[model samples]
Target: METINARSWVERFIKTVVDQAGELTELDRRAGDGDYGTNLRSALRRVEANLAGVASDAPDAVFTAVSDGFLNTGGTSGPLFGMWFREFTRSPELTTAALAEAAAGGVAVVQRLGKAEVGHKTMVDAMVPAAEALTAAAGRDEPLAEAVRAAASAAHTGAASTESLLAKRGRASYVGENARGVVDPGALTVALFFDAAS
Candidate 1:
């Protein structure tokens, strides 16, 4: 079995977002405030800074840093992401079963707090699919990489589906018809997170 490195996973997620911040912001600009990228980057910066002080490779410690950064950020997406990452900190081990549980926990908290369902065209869309994929993968005793890959695939598909959905929640909802062609940045971010885990 491959040991999932929490620090490495976080580093990859940070890099992926940093490289694609402009694209994410552009998506937000089309349907919502153009601050999604900026807020996400700021939170990532905090995560990076916090990571410097965490000498341990434990999943909980690294995820706590991730959670803290997002929680401190100012935005609806930030807080939701913060709570989601916080769920991951519940288990020190990053085993497949633990990932499934964390994903389910994260989805529950995000849904409860955001009040967004799968068809609501929010982060919950991608989050729900990713969690389901992780659960299925865990049930099959799949390898960590395979599980993450499945999650990423599901998340990406869910994010893509958002392009055709008329937003029912968040800033996009206010725009009505304009948001139809644009993908939800939050959903895309969820997809990126799962991809990083791979």
Candidate 2:
């Protein structure tokens, strides 16, 4: 019943990332340079700017703005996260299935861009599972709220499960077995997005 307009969705997303920035930075510190939080926050600001002339009712337009902002912002996350928003825009509407489809598209983009697949200790590992869970929930006739909640839970579980996976993508890939016990920052960040939407 809590259908958010584009502006509200954008604000919620910004707040989610900002609130979780420290956590994301900590995760990155384990294997990366600890810039995921900074990158995402900066990108969100750009997204806000891009939305200045756009209508909040147009979720697709908002999505496009997000993708463009991320792409222009520059960073590994730029392409990785950008693909997710771009994929969301490809959907017909901002329905539960559309969100799932966007998550799927994100995973696919990460695979193609990073040359990493499932079980590779990347965001795709978490996102792919979350997307499947959302899709399954939709198939079961769950309400949009319930479906998003399920997806957020799945994303969290998937991110936690990453602690057991060896590094095979991004900076973590260089860490090999050392990355096994740490959750991926990017994966955790994506989970936060699900939490925001839910």
lDDT of the structure predicted as candidate 1: 0.94
Candidate 2 residues lying further than 4 Å off, grouped into runs, are: none
lDDT digits (tens) for residues 44-135 of candidate 2: 88888888867655778888888888887666876778877788777546777777677777777777888877777778777887899888
Q: Let me know the TM-score candidate 1 reaches against the reference structure.
A: 0.98
C-alpha displacement of 189 in model 2, angstroms?
A: 0.9
Best by TM-score: 1
Given candidate 2, what's the lDDT at residue 45? 85
- Per-candidate local distance difference test: 0.94, 0.77
**Which window of 10 residues has the lowest lDDT sum in candidate 1?**
1-10
Q: Return the lDDT, model 2, position 196.
A: 76
Clashes of 1: 0
Q: What is residue 149's positional error in candidate 2, in angstroms?
A: 0.8
